[model samples]
Target: MMSKSNKMLDVQAMDTSSNTVLSVRHLKTYFYPDDGSVRKAVDDVSFDVQRGRICCLIGESGSGKSATAMSIINLVDRPGKVTGGNVLFGGRDLLTLDTKQLRTVRGASIGMIFQEPMHSLDPVFTIGEQIVETILAHEDVPRVEAAERAVTWLKRVELPNPEAIMTAYPHELSGGMLQRAMIAIALCCGPKLLIADEPTTALDVTVQAQILRLLVRLKDEIGLSILLITHDLGVVAETADDVLVMYDGHIVERGPVEAVFDRPQHPYTKALLLTRPIIGQKLRRLPTLHEVMREVDDGEIAQPKDWSTLATTVQTDGDKGEAHSTDANGNDHDSTPILTVRHLSKYFERVHGLKGEGNVKKAVDDVSFDVHRGETVGLVGESGSGKTTTGQTVLRLHSKTAGEVLFDGIDVFALNNRKLAKLRTRMQYVFQDPYSALNPRLKIGFAIGEALLHHKLATKRDVMDKVVETLELCGMDSSCVNRYPHEFSGGQRQRIVIARAMALQPEFVVADEPVSALDVSIQAEIINLFSELQHRKNVSFLFISHDLSVVEHICSSILVMHHGRITERGTVDDVFNHPKDDYTKSLLDSIPASNPKYRKIGR
Candidate 1:
């Protein structure tokens, strides 16, 4: 076995002559808030990126992953400053370099791919113009040559119709196209070191898979070193040769990918690994970070009650269940279709050239599905595949251009405003972004209780009690009702949102990307919560998500969508084990296996 010092990459060996591309030691980045206190965003962090190797930094939001990357690039702006650290690139200390010298090295020697490509790209300029600017900034290339190079890189990234896309603005391109554009810009200068921060976080599974493949291919084709920062373990398992796990501003774990995953030494690392939802390994409940590490748990995370008993109550108390479950022969047909959508279509008109007749974009084209009672139906697809639009159209969140929606046998599309408003009490929607879901000024209690009162299900005096009960069902407590959305963490805020959605005791719900933004640990918690809710309340869910691994865990039935059409649909085992369509196969292929043993070669 290698010694402790040999277990990790050594920067001392760099010695102004080694092949280490970038090395950071004892890095400290702190911020001074208005409360007169110092917050260490990155503390005592150390890592190295070697030549032609991919080193990944995995952590949740505020775990100092992005801060560390920005610090390496010396881009930390005001109020936040790098207090102490040594960043050595090509034997030169980056901190000691003047602005002019650092500028020269920025793009010429280093390239960066940001998490959100749209934000980094200029809205007014075409994609080609941006790439040309990058090339000209670092090299003495002429305008025509730079433009040609831009088109070449776009084609290299496998973007469709590269030349046509080059002349389009950022808004004119799709999410995947824009990301490829960003890659073209970053690589136009031919840098040696690539720093990619959550490059595929917001993309669809297929697009994300394609992007991951492209990055790996680029690393090999160029023989360049890569420093990847992301929270997705699947991405790390597939792309990383070395791994760094961060938590609360500390490098809690570090080693080769196989070594770290096969034998996780740190409690945080172990918990994070356990928290991820694998293909066939299902856990009873996903524990939080506090459960794994005693220091972070705060002793207040809510525990779930027996879910079977909860479902029994819903079945016995509600008269609707009995009415809907009986067959003509007096036998029970419990697997009744609760929500039915047929030939549903949603479209938007796009105005061109400021005045001509608009072009119609069919967001949801002839979609159809039936969600059975007590069963979770997963609507899986890539971004712009029309999954969200289908869900919204079924819920009548947006008026459908065509087709029919049946909720418990009532024609939802034919219902008038008053009837539709009344029907909404039984059908609800959970938004993707929890941080923006709840009202900022409203207390948690008000946010939840408003739903109860609006539906006339609870009195003014009983609303708080109902809110508390809903919160409890969601693994929260009455104490949380007094807090605001901003005070809670991302996972906690999602719980609050779930609590509000369930406050009306809705039988069917459209949950859109519910846990995509959360850490794996928190994701497990939410999934467990959903499992319990499903078994207890028997509430059917139309769970819409871009992540196939996550959808594979909680969904009983899966529907695959691509280009606004349902390409495939079946039970989890039938669809996942024996995929039929090409698009479906690609989605399954894209799911990064959680285990290192399953890591594919040349990903």
Candidate 2:
């Protein structure tokens, strides 16, 4: 069915792959702030993603990894301008393309899978309609033919009942289902390249694994090049052929995946890899970005004045203080039990089959956990394991179908509306995404200060003082008070979220995968910030994450969830050392490490 000439061209492309499918040279993306200066988001960065190999664009939040990805797709809107450099794709300079020309190549030549599936999907459109629309946009294909392709692609991505899913709206689908649907839609256009920007950041561990495997399989089958923008080094080890390390809008290092991991030439890359929580590492506080940056500055490289000044600022008032409680071992562990859940359960109705007999899906089944005062208790599991559900239930965001949630020994579920509102003052949550969780209309000062106003914690004058203080406490400056979340970088926004969380000086906090959305180094800083807050404020934490390494790093105690049940619970050392549950052992073993040298490329 394939034309001889087209097949020849494909083979030729593979043979001359060294020519580079996409080459970015001296690229600079600048955001002109209202103050008239450029932000220099992606400054003088260069890298190449080959025709058949996966290229990983790695960085911490605000290191400009995502900005580079958006720039390549011409998705950088106004205020943000591509100030310089060439984005060469298939020998053609994409930077020179007009709006019409860019549109012609966008979905057809390059497909994009965004970070959040929930926000990316159109609320009104059915999943099938979205996929079909994507396909027909590029090619004038028949509706029936496009629909069939959509179904097949959905099934290929391991979605169950493709037909049923096709008819379902995005809201009706689970997080994993919606993500798979987004992938199916992206692939519908048969693009030569795929830009996956932290695509698995929102999914749980098992689901994230499945999605990564699916992408690798698709790439192997079709030889479609992938540009994976992620902060997860484990993902790079598992999926990338070559790694491009970005720091401060520049490529500090680039090499084969194994080489980068095994013998990292850059100090920043080395710090990122080691600072990450791994199975064997104890749940101890990691060094802050300030510390790492200091080390980098003091080491072989001399500190630039700008970086030196920034580091000085972070040390003075930026660190809020540790949030973890000390255990008997003098390690970070809170034994006070600030929040405790006993036999908590939540269920949902799921349509069974064609007979339409709905079955109750036990989302959180008989799950029990404890969050100690001044300690971080990590809740980790696969997507369907109900980690988020448990967190939400503890927060009363989702009413527990059965069981008791006690906050500071007070029954949270038993509290009246007014009592609950009063109780909320001492408890807060930080979401995985700062963009969605934040009120865009409110300035950073107002958003962080709003909680103080609601709780009557401070007067009008005190509010501004508190806002500036909170911002500084979270590693930001007083000057950021009037700035909106949109005006800040991803790392800055996350810091603002942390600032907001600290506004009330709450005794307990639920940090739901806060760092999973951040780049590795940014994650390190945030984790350290949480550690500092715990020590200083003595607040307990329910740290929910799919990333085991991160959990191992920050959590004093670990609760392993499987199929909505507590499979294992123990101190970081006990669980990592013994791992009584086979499921827990399996999860630990599944983490991708630095690839061995000379292993088969595609196994």
Candidate 3:
């Protein structure tokens, strides 16, 4: 057994003179708000990134992981200053360096890949121009030479048609392509240390896999050390040589990946690992971080008395013991499908170069599926696979270019404005981004009740009461009604969004990546909430997501979409256990294994 000090990676005990690429000691970053309250974002955090190794910083949102990373590079912005820290890189204390000196070290010795590449990369510049600019900032190379190097870097990052990508604007590229461009820009100068902050969070599963594989390959080829900051445990298990578990501004635990995951010492670490939904381990409800922390004993996590009961049943009440069961023709014969999409197609016309010549892009082409009542029918695909477009088209959020959408036997597309408005009461859409889905200026109560009142579903006097009840049902407090959207966390905001949708008592919902931006524990809570709602209300759902493991857990059946078409459709058991389509198989294979022992070796 390793001693506590040994497992903690104590900086004093280790020989940091040789192998350590970057050493952060007693880092403290505090934010001073206008109200004069000092919030400790990163408090006394210490860690070492070994040369040519990946050290994953794992934590929930607001746990100071990103702050610690930013502080190391002396990039903590105004209002949030690094109170105290020693960031030693190449025998130089970065904190002591001035603005000009720090700038020299930033791109030359250390590179950073932000979570959102679109925001990180300048919108006005071409991908090639940005990479060249980065190179020019650090080195005294000729403009022509820098341009050539940029193309080389793009190729090295495994981007296809490097020359075209260089000439293309950031908006012209896909999410995955933009990310690759960001990596190219960061690594063009050949930085020894890389800080990747949630680089794959918003990406599709396959794209994420590609990015992770690219990072590993680059590390091997260039001998680059990485400080990978993320809230995902699976990513840590798959890629990290060492692990740092952070909580609320403290380094709760630090150790080798195998040791930390196999035998977690801290209660928080254990809770994080246990709360995440595994691919095959189906449970009635996933235990939340709060539940696990409540049962903490000493430094270890203790399961609650009812923990055993939580795993007893894989089927929810809505399943009615018919989970993964389908008829001979791969249809639910028990009842007619609540929502049917036949030959659905959505197209966008692109006018190029002001030539007056328009080319039609088929976003969704001949897509068809059925979502049965009291069932969760998953729509799984890559980012541009038309999942979102299909969902929106079904809800009439986007005017369909072709085909028919029958909701409870009424053609949704053929409805008049007044009839469509009435039909909206029976159907609702949960957008991907909860923050953007809501009106920021509106109070939580008003945001929820406005729809009800406008639809004449509730009177003005009783609207607040109805709002409070729905909020509570979604695992929130009655007090949340008076609060604004900006006041709540990402998970809480998602709950509020769900509450707003449920308040309508819609028979069918088009949930589009509702839990994609959330923490793992929060995702479990939301998934469990969905299950509870389905069980209680017997409502059907068209759950659209790129996450296959999540879909496997909550969805009874699934439809695999690729190139705006349903390539395959079947029960969860048939599709997941024995996928016929190649795309479906690749997606399942892309899911990172939670255990390091089973980590995929290569792309």
lDDT of 2 at 552: 74
**Candidate 3 to truth, TM:** 0.92
User: Which candidate, 1 or 3, has the higher TM-score?
Assistant: 3
Which residue pairs clash in candidate 3? none
Collision count for each candidate, in order: 2, 15, 0
lDDT on C-alpha atoms for all candidate structures: 0.81, 0.78, 0.85
Q: Write the per-residue lDDT of candidate 1 for residues 1-603, one digit (tens) a residue.
A: 112211232223322337678889889999888888998998988878888989999988988999999899898987899999899897788878889998988888989989899999999999989999989998897899999999999999999998898889999988888888888888888888989999999887777878888888999999878999999999998889889888878887788898877776665676577567777643334444444444213332122122222222222112222222111121222478999899998999988785677888988999999988877888998878898989888988899898899999999989999999999989999989998988999999998888788889999988888889999889888899889999999999999888899888889889999999998888977876786676677788899998877777777778998889999999877898999999888778878867667866373
Q: Residue 532 deviation, candidate 2, in Å? A: 2.9
- Candidate achieving the largest lDDT: 3
Model 1 lDDT at residue 525: 76
**Residue by residue across 330-416, what tens digits does model 2's lDDT show?**
354445678878999999888878899998888999987777677778888876788888888888999888998888889998888
Index of the highest-TM-score prediction: 3
- Model 1 regions more than 4 Å off: 1-17, 294-333, 601-603
The per-residue C-alpha lDDT of model 3 at residue 85 equals: 72
RMSD, every candidate, angstroms: 6.7, 8.2, 4.2
